[model samples]
Target: MLNLVLFGPPGAGKGTQSQKLIDKYQLVHISTGDLFRAHIKNQTDLGKQVSQLIADGELVPDSITIAMLEEEVDRNKTAKGFIFDGFPRTVPQAEELDRFLESKGAKVNGVIALDVNQEELTRRIAERHKLNGRPDDDAEKLKKRIGEYFDKTIHVLPYYEAQGKLAKVNGIGEIEIIFNSLCEVIDSF
Candidate 1:
């Protein structure tokens, strides 16, 4: 299985690239953000809890996030592989994911970290906000999200790097260019 974790700050085009990866590799795109939205839309028990937290502008607890991911993994056991986006946002979550994958007799084959400049990310997010009317795309929320990404999530990169599973990809170019770069890296594995 060619399991991959696509890591990057919000607005770094993780979602965009994940779609291409899914198309090219036929991998399951397991995005925690999408999962949370699905749950909230379905009004599931976990969804209700996460909805409340999001409504209060709070981060959902790590345990809750991990549980959702575990459920998804279980549901997709027959998948060729998984491309994880917007997940394992903390060191603890990364550890938990490793353990979960190990139990399934698999491991994360690579972690692709998309490196984009802050200004470019902000610009891209602003453009998205204009187009999508997403409630969480305001400047304040964006800043807070990016801050959290660096403070809490970036540490996960070193953990994967130490395991020799981290691949850094430049995320500042055209969409096809970035997607191609990511594909090259994944193909190397």
Candidate 2:
């Protein structure tokens, strides 16, 4: 299976590009953000917990996140592959994901890291907030989420790099241009 991880900070266009990748590659798109949002919207027990943590801009505990992800993966047993987005935000999470995938006799084929500067990320997020108005898109929450990414999540890149499964794609361009760059990387895989 051609499992892939699309890594980037919030508002780095991971969501946008993931859709295109899903269309072209026919991969199951597992986005933790979307998962959390669904739970929150449904007001499940897990959703209630996630809602508060997200309102506070804290990362969900690995156990909860992992369990949720595994369930999604299990539900899509016949998928050709998976495009993981907004997940494995820490080295431990990445390690756990490796273990989980290994048990299923699959492996992450590669990681694509979108390289977008902080300023651009902030600007794009601001625009997105205007359009979507997601609670987490508020300026204060966005700041914390972005900080959390750079402070801790970005370290996961090195973990993948060490495995020679990391590719960097410039994320400062038109949507199609950036999408083409990402496709080139995934195609190489």
Candidate 3:
């Protein structure tokens, strides 16, 4: 099994590269953001809780997020592996994931951190806003989100790096080029 985690700031192309990786590796793509949005759209009990948190611009509690992931993993264990996107945003969550996978005798094979310049990230996010019409895509929210990512999630990199599972890839090129770079890294692993 080739469980993997793709980590990056918003607009750093994590989603795009995850799609490529999923297609190439036949791995299940578990995107927490997508999961949350789906739950919210369906108005599940958990979704109601998360929706309120999101409305208040607060992070969904890790327990809630992990519960959602646990359900997905339980259902998808038959898959070859998984590509975790936009998840494990904290050290505690990472640790929980480690334990969960350990119980299944599976561990993350790699963590790919997509590195990109902040200016370029902002520009790309602005373009995405125009294209996707997401209400939260404004400059102020984007900057705040980026700042929060660095503040809360940046430390998780070293945790994976110490385990010899973190690979940093430049995220500023053509889509194919960036995807190729990620593929090369994964292939090495």
Candidate 4:
């Protein structure tokens, strides 16, 4: 299986690129944020807990997140591969993912990070706010989210890098252009 981790800050086009990659690779897109939203919308027990935490601008606990992810992996028994979009925000979570995947006789193929500057991300957030009315794009929330990425989440990159499975694609300019670059890296992987 060609399991992948699509890494990026918010508004760095992770969602956009993930769609393209899924179409091209026929991979299951396992986006934790999406899963949370779906669960919350459906009012599942897990979703209720996640929604409360998210409403407080807090992260879901790693144990809960990993259990949800494990269920997802188990559900997709015949998947070509999986593109993990937003889980494993910490090194420990990454370690957990590794162990979980190993149990399934699969492993991460690579991590593809969309590298974008803060200025560009700010600009994109503005556009997204206007286009989608995303309340989480407020300045304070953006700062916290971006700060979290740099302070904590970005550290996950090196864990993958040490494994020689991390690749970066410039996250500026046209969507297709960025996607083409990502395709190059993924194909090589």
Candidate 5:
């Protein structure tokens, strides 16, 4: 199994590249943000809790996020692999993911971190907010999310780096160019 963690801050183009990776590699794309949005849209019990935390610009508790991720993975037992996007944001989360994957005799093959500067991310997200109008895309929430990534989530990079499983891709170019760069990393694996 060729599992991957697509790591990046909000507005770093993780979602766009994830789609291309899925197409080329036939990977199940498990984006926590997408899962949260789906639940919120469905108005499930978990959605109610996630919605409020998201509205307040807070990270969802690790336990809830991990459980949701495990359920998604379980549902796709025969998947060729999985692209984990917007997940394992903290060191603890990464450790938990490693343990979970180990139980199934699989492991994360690689972790790709999209390297985009804050200014660029802000600009891109501003444009995206105008188009998508996702509540979390509002300026205030975006700031918080970005701060959260830099302050806490970025630590996850070194965890993988220590294992020699982290690769960085520049995220400030044309979509195809960036996707191609990501493919090179995955191909190397």
Candidate 6:
């Protein structure tokens, strides 16, 4: 199984590359943000908790996020592997994910972090705002989300790095160029 964690700051093409990775690798894509949105849309018990935290621009606690991810993972018993996007944002969560996956006899094969600088991320997010009209894409919220990644999410890189499972790919280029770069990393594994 080729379990991968797609790591990066906001607007770093994680989502776009995740799709290509899924198509080529035949992996299930488990995006926590998408899962939270679905739960919130359905007004499930977990969604209620996540909705309030998200509205305040806060991350849902690790326990809740882990449980939600485990449920999703459990549902896909026959998946060849999984691409975990927008998850394991903190080191503790990374540890938890490792433990959970171990319980199921799987492990994270690699972490491909799209290394886009803040300036380019801002530009891409701004363009995404105009294209999608996502509420969180507004300038202030974008700043916060990006800040959170720098402050919190980046820490997880070292965790995977220590495990020799990290591949830092340049993330400022044409879509196919970046995807090709990511494909190189995946193909190596």
Clashing residue pairs in candidate 3 are none
lDDT values for all models = 0.89, 0.95, 0.89, 0.90, 0.95, 0.92
Predicted structure 4, TM vs. truth: 0.95
**Where in model 3 is the C-alpha error above 4 Å?**
none
Q: lDDT by residue for model 1 over 5-113, one digit each (tens)?
A: 9999989999999988999999999998889888998999988889866644456899999998999999987899999998888888999999999999999999999
> What's the CA error at residue 7 for candidate 6, in Å?
0.6
Candidate 4 clashing pairs, residues 3+ apart or interchain: none
Taking every candidate in turn, the Cα RMSD to the unseen true structure, in Å, is 1.2, 0.6, 1.2, 1.2, 0.6, 1.0
- Higher lDDT: candidate 1 or 6? 6
Off by over 4 Å in 4: none
The local lDDT score (0 to 100) that residue 121 gets in candidate 5 is 96
Write down the lDDT that model 5 would get: 0.95
Q: How close is candidate 1 to the true structure, as a TM-score?
A: 0.96
lDDT of 6 by residue, 16-39 (tens): 989988999899999998899899
Model 4 lDDT tens row, 71-111: 99999999999999887899999999999999989899999
What is the lDDT, from 0 to 100, of the residue 134 in candidate 5? 87
Give stretches of model 5 more than 4 Å off: none
Predicted structure 2: lDDT: 0.95
lDDT digits (tens) for residues 1-189 of candidate 2: 999999999999999999999999999999999999999999998899899999888999999999999999999999999999998999999999999999999999999999999999999999999999999999999999999999999999999999999999999999999999998999899
lDDT of 5 by residue, 45-159 (tens): 8899899998878999999999999999999999999999988999999999999999999999999999999999999999999999989999999999999999999999999
> Which candidate, 2 or 3, would have the higher TM-score against the true structure?
2
